[model samples]
Target: MLHIFCPHCGELRSEEEFHASGQAHIARPLDPAACSDEEWGTYMFYRDNPRGIHHELWDHVAGCRQYFNVTRNTVTYEILETYKIGEKPQVTADGKQTNAPSTVKGQGEKV
Candidate 1:
């Protein structure tokens, strides 16, 4: 079992004490009523399922009962860092910021 360090509790605890929530830092729509059906649907259902580095939200369920962010490697299952919700992650894939969209090489032919 993996031992996770709780930011709030300031102690390392077992995995059973924490609940792995979905992707962290998801921004909720400011005006939900104004959002289109597609936008709202994407907000509710869409999440990043990348292969390498992943940032996740974890709740200290059995300990402090507070939520925090964990930067972990998906392939090796290694926990890189555990931080508070508002804090930015230090480790990133390829040392590049992943917020921007990657460029596609080919263009579609006109029909």
Candidate 2:
């Protein structure tokens, strides 16, 4: 069983207690009407399935019932860090750690 940390609850809990929602930091289209059908469809349907490091949205269903972001390694199934919805992650996809928050928008951002 995997242990997942819920940033809201600040506790390590069982994987069964949580649910993986999807990819993190998805930005909603500013104007749905303005977007082409393909654009809207892409926004609603497309998601990344990377082989290595990934940022995902997860929910603490059995505990806090809040959404959080998780930086994990897909190959090893190792969770690098758990962060709150709006907080920046310490680890990046390139395997670098930084003390400062990332300026790149839509990366691990909440929809």
Candidate 3:
């Protein structure tokens, strides 16, 4: 079983204590009531299922009962990092720290 570190609880807990909610970073529509059925449906149901690094929202149901973000590998099922809702991940999809200098020159913007 994969041991997941809960950012809120500050302890490593078993995976059974949590539940994978879905794809993270889903932005709610600016005006939900103004959306058409098709638009609303797409916003509510559409999610990306990538083969590589995937960011997910998880709920610590059996622990602190708080929700957090998890960056994990889809194929290897490796939990890269867990963080609070408002915090940016230290690592990126290419397995590099966000603050690290890039190889390409003049492209130092956050992706």
Candidate 4:
């Protein structure tokens, strides 16, 4: 029942319209042959589930069929921003202002 914002469509939609692909912004090993098992395991299992704000990758399964980032409040379920694949997350150019994206209505409660 979560509402996910589609960066491509600029619409908030039900969670059903989206699919969690996995962790986003993962840096792949530049030299896989040089990596140890421990290093690979660390990359695979470690996650930063911070309490206040978090960035995640989500796919607009039913909408744009594209993947985007979402900045949401973990505790309040408030989405701070939803932006295109490579664009900034609604941040000011000077990086001083912080504006959370507004929620669109008629969507389910979760997402």
Best-matching candidate per TM-score: 2
lDDT of 2 by residue, 1-111 (tens): 678877777677788888999999999998999999999999999999999889999998899899989898888888878888787888888878977965322222121
RMSD score of candidate 3 (Å): 8.0
Q: How many residue pairs clash per model? A: 0, 1, 0, 4
What ranking of all candidate models by lDDT puts the best one first?
2, 3, 1, 4
Per-prediction TM-score: 0.83, 0.87, 0.84, 0.72
Better of 1 and 3 by lDDT: 3
Ranking by TM-score: 2, 3, 1, 4
Error of 1 at 97 (Å): 10
Per-residue alpha-carbon lDDT of model 1 for 8-80, expressed as tens digits? 8778777888899999889999999999999999999999998878889999999889998887777777777
CA displacement after TM-score superposition, residue 80 of candidate 2 (Å):
0.2
Candidate 2: residue 71 lDDT (0-100): 90
Worst 10 residues of 4 by lDDT: 102-111
Q: What is the C-alpha RMSD of each candidate to the true structure, in Å?
A: 12.4, 6.1, 8.0, 5.4
C-alpha lDDT of all candidate models, in order:
0.76, 0.81, 0.79, 0.66
Query: RMSD to the native, candidate 4?
Result: 5.4
Off by over 4 Å in 1: 95-111
Off by over 4 Å in 4: 90-111
